[model samples]
Target: MSDILKGLEPERVFRYFEEICAIPHGSGNEKAISDYCVAFAKSHNLWFRQDEANNVIIRKPASEGYEDAPIVMLQGHMDMVCEKNSDVDFDFEKEGLKLRIVDDMIYASGTTLGGDDGIAVAYALAILEDDHLAHPELEVVITTDEEVGMDGARALDVSDLKAKYLLNLDNEEEGQILTSCAGGMKSRAAIPTRHVEWEGVSAVIRISGLKGGHSGAEIHCGRANANRLLGRVLMNLNKELNVGVREVNGGMKDNAIPREAEAKIVLDPEDIQRAMEIKNEFVAAIADEFAVSDPDIRIELNVECNENRQHTIIHPADMERALFVFIQSINGIQTMSMELPGLVESSLNLGIVRTEEDNVNFAWAIRSSKKSLKYLMSDQLQYLAEFVGGTYWYEGEYPHWSFKSDSKLREVVASSYRDLFGKEARIEAIHAGLECGLISEKMPDLDIVAIGPDIHDIHTPGEHLSIPSVERSYRLICDVLSRLKA
Candidate 1:
């Protein structure tokens, strides 16, 4: 509890947010949260339904005069990505997200704030409880497991929903209506590893302090991918020095940019000093290369001479192949939309890389608005992985929501926003994945547009919510509902 949030408007919404923050609702672990939602609905005596996947939909009848209006659906995911600072000891599945308010922004203490979709849930709850706000019949869909995949939303039986127009409360920006989003798939490459004896001195080369971000949303922002950068260093070292790698690890999640990477390698004792010098030179080059973006990049090496104690190391040939493939993997935005300037049409993220007991696994995410392009990029990644003597597996493949220029609900929302703010609202497409794609697949005629208050650093531990933006967005949504009913 902070002084800043204590005085915010719509105390009920903030109160609910605080309560949710105190609940452990990580993806795939939403039973407690789902039960809470069911209890809330029961206490209100509202009609509700819960699917087998734990998705909950509660119906609130429109105010007296608005019952005849078209039904509107308010949607947001209940589950959140469980991310934390490397040094944080909190367990996401059991520990509540510790929240703090600073300078009007609400953030978690070393863990994700869950504002990505939690604020949406709170806002919906507030609206459901408020009898004063004017609105048409409302259906609030609180879905589960949206972070790992749209499991809940995808599993939901859309036949139960009567809403023809849906407002998704999952967008990160205020005043911007997200009408479409890219389709995405997570691909993994696994290469078998056979460890060999460590015949020389060992040292760990660590890279840290690189600015990592959302692989999809921030891919075009030119932020350096630490995994790719570390691979480059390894490739260069293998060429310049006689070294054997014991293990290489970086990043934990597939969606987040890797902030740190460490490589354990065995090098000739005589080459330790030379290796240190090379590490410094490489760091300097990277700092200069990403000066405009990752200014805080750091690279360091620790030296220790030890006999060949390990049972094995990755074969030299396999290590070279893995490093080369990783370096050659093109990441970030590969194509820009011709119809919309600066919008990413297709992109790839070299997300996670790690060495297991017997194999090395690399993860990637590819997103595109065009279905053909999505598969094209995925095929390319598969080919690249095969070429490197690795196998590729895909998961969480979701379709893109194609933009519709003549959406009636879009027009209604736009007019309402203009009437309230006396200015035009921006309608745009996002590169991030949304459940709207799968929902639309089930309900073809459903008109969907996503909106939300301003939130930053989503899916990361640095996530925060803007209080003022939440107030404004709340008012806008209420006004939009009023106009739709009228």
Candidate 2:
């Protein structure tokens, strides 16, 4: 364990968290972490399996008196979204996260803290390694690549053993017991491009500093997506300057709302001053518009002469249609659930926009609790992409976990929480996607409930894990396990 987290309660859990932080375990890069878990199982004399997808399942037998109890599975994903500040020179593939603590929260230096599911892995590891903990025959299943999509969980084979009850440790908020979660899929539209040589005044117009967050969890916050905002900026400029876009690029993942976006544009030399004035106008307007949700939104500019230097640029006509696809698209909360108060039933986020040589690929992580509404949003995107002569496709589709009305595990968890926290844990459904969705689909008989410590600003560089919440949640988990011995 690192000296900074040495004496924290649940020593084994923090020790394992420090160990996980010391390894590079980002999405699509989980071999090292998977191997670490296998080694732990080997050293602890537990049966384990590591699949080709890098998903690990470590099993421990029940304690002497609890052999008759039903099997329980503790689950979490092994991967973290590798996001960092553009200025930070951190190599996620080569180096581990640099962790720091500010009072009660633990954060990574200019990178994601990985507490979204790392805490889940650490809790499961600590439970598996502790011989005295009164869990039933435990199946500690840790999957990978959950951030991009649930690729690992989708490929997992669950025919080995039986687990009637499964507790997912991937929930972010500490006090909420996630009973249901929305389904999701990746939507990509490759807009075919035609290039032209344009030599004139060129500038890189950037929209940045917006409080980008997870497309699902925080989409309702009314934060401005930098990629879409960039499109709006160009549309405003083209009315006077007739700007031709060279290459528009923004965002990193299909699951995170872009914090920064920039476009290289070609325009007439005389219109340069007008463009600046237009940018300033929109800056003031957007700042006032998103003041409450995205207070730090900014639009910046840097001009240069592209004259005498021929460059490959997209035709102004084609680029204008692409901009329209962004500005006129349906994004954010599409419909609110009347059944559940304050629940978002359907939504989509323009999570990524990239300029390729042949096309500009726009990808979104579409989400909805209702399957019909989910595909309806996809249909809308398809029409927009085809209207602009672009090819549209979708992948990484996953199912949803519905709310269970009769659950013995929920009552056990609630009773345990009240015993420890002096109040009932909030029973609710999150709009975000969870592996429980897929697991419940595969193993329909399993009673699954998702819970976790307080994870703030997940899928972003500002992510932090609450220290006290971890300690409390671990206590509640242990109590629940002890009570489930029947």
Candidate 3:
């Protein structure tokens, strides 16, 4: 066990958390961790099932006096988003996360901490091993590839399970009970390109230091997207200077806002100083515009003197088409819910832009609670792409987990929180996507409520888990379980 978690309250949770951190379990690469879970269940002499897709279900009988209680299911995913700083050399497929603690929070060195859903797995494992805790028969379902999509939940066979009350341990905030989440789908737009062998002085413009975050949770914050900023700058520069694009690349995941982007362009040597001035002006304007939301936005222009160079540049008209498609498409919170104050009903994120050998691709994620609105937004995106001489498609669509008016699970959890903390827990629906939406579809009769300890800045290298929040949330879960009745 790592000493970073030593002497922490609820030692088992932290122990398991540290142990899981030692195994590389990025999305779609969960075999090692899945087998570790199987070994855990085997060592405990519990019944378990491991599916081909690496989803695991472990069953344990109820503790004394709770035999007649309704069976309870605890669900969390086994995968996490693997992100790192540009200078970091960590590999998610080969190396375990390097754990560290600062200010009572656990973080991974130069990489994402994987605390989003890893904490959930640790909680479930700790609860299952505790012999004295009062609860019904427990069914722990740990799904895989949740960050990429709800593929594991979609493929899992849950018919054999008898649990009807499920507690999803995926929410990031300790005091917020997420009862519903937005439905989402990934869209890809590819614009074909032709190149010509002609070059002048070439320079690369980079945009960085934007406070990128989860595209779903932070889309409404008005954070700057590096990809969008680069596109706008390129278009704006085209109006003043003669420039040809060689490459445009930014972002990695469709669910994360682009934090940094770069574009390589060929320009006349005489326009170098003017281009630098234009870049500085644009940067100043952007910093002022996003001062409140993304105060640390940085736009850097790196120019190298390549004299009489001959390199491939995208055809001028095709480059204009690509830039137009990026600048015109809808990105960020499109509409807010009228019924719920401060709730985002529909949104889009231009999450990634890449320049391939023969084409430039733009990736986006469209989300909405309403199915029609989700498709409508997608249709609009497709129209924008095709209007600019490109083609688009959608994939990995997951449905929304709509809020239920009457929920025994919610009432019990809220009352438990009030009893423990002498205060009310916030109950609301989040705009982010959760696997609960897909799992609820398989088991329509399941009573579900999502809860978790506090994890901040998920899906980014800045992710961290609060130690005190984990202790309080663990106590709350134990209190809720002790109060459960048939």
Candidate 4:
């Protein structure tokens, strides 16, 4: 184990956590981590299964006196989001995260700490290997590609799972238990375009320093999407003068709000001066509007070719279609839940935009607590994209992990929490998508709740995990397991 987390409480759990951090386990690249888990099971002499999709299931019979109790499932994904600072030179595909510590928190040097679910994997592995624990039959599941989408959970086979109760260790807060979460999907819209040679002036317009975050978790924060902001700047500029797009590109993932976006455009030489004035006006207006949400927002325009120059740009009609999608696509918190106060009911994010040789493709992440609402938002996008002669498709559709009227597992967990902390744990619903949504769709009878240690800023470079919180949460999970009865 690395010295950064040396001598931490629940030493076994951190040991596994440090071991896995030594391997690159980003989403869609989980084979190494999956195989690592397999090797762990082999060394421990535990029964396990490794699927083609890199999902792992390790089964352990209950302890001597608890064999008659109902089976309990511990679940979390194996993959982490690969996010780093632009200046960080680390290679996610080939390098292990550089672990560091300050005060009670653990962080990876200039990269995401992967604590969102990696700690869950460590917790499950620790329990699985502890033969002295007084627990019911255990089924520990580690899934893959959960950050981009719940692909691993969607493809997971639960027919053989005997667990009637599942404990999902994917929640971020220590004292909060998530009983329900929103359903979501990722979509792509491709607007066909053709290039043409033209003689004109061009400049690259950039929007940066916007505070981007997980689309589902932070959409209600009112931070502006960089892609949408760029679109607005271009749309207003185009109306004043003839403009043709050389290309537009922004954002990295469909599920992350864009932090930076840029576009190259060709326009009349005489319009360049007017465009600068318009750009300044927009900067001041937008800075004031989003001052509270994104305090550091910036816009920069760099002249690449100011003189009449030969250039290849999108056809006028095709450029119009691309711009139409940028402006017309639905985004942000669309509705607030009447049932749950202060919760977003439905929303979407125009998370990514890319202009290529044949098409200008736009990607989105749509989320909603209600299935109908989620579908309604997605359907609107599909039609709008098609309205402009573009093609649309989608993937990673997940169902809502709806709150149950009464849950024995909830009672057990609540009782355990009160016993340990002398206070009630917060039980709430979230706007974000958790793998519980996919698992519940497969095992409707399973009583499930998500719990985790203190992890902050998940899916981002500044992400960190609380070391002390991990020990406490691990004890709570263990206590909960000891109380489970047939």
Q: Which pairs clash inside model 2?
A: none
- Structural similarity to truth (TM-score) of each candidate: 0.96, 0.98, 0.98, 0.95
Better of 1 and 4 by TM-score: 1
Could you give the C-alpha RMSD of every candidate to the true structure, in order shown?
Answer: 1.8, 1.2, 1.2, 1.8
User: CA lDDT of each candidate?
Assistant: 0.85, 0.90, 0.90, 0.89
Q: Give the deviation of candidate 2 from the true structure as CA RMSD.
A: 1.2
Choose 1 or 4, whichever is better by lDDT: 4
TM-score between candidate 3 and the true structure? 0.98
What's the TM for model 4?
Answer: 0.95
Better of 1 and 2 by TM-score: 2
How far off is model 3, as Cα RMSD?
1.2
lDDT of 2 by residue, 239-304 (tens): 777777899999888889889899998767778788889999999999899999999887987787
lDDT measured at residue 392 in model 2 versus the true structure, 0 to 100 = 95
Give every collision pair in model 4. Answer: none
Q: Give the clashing pairs for model 3.
A: none
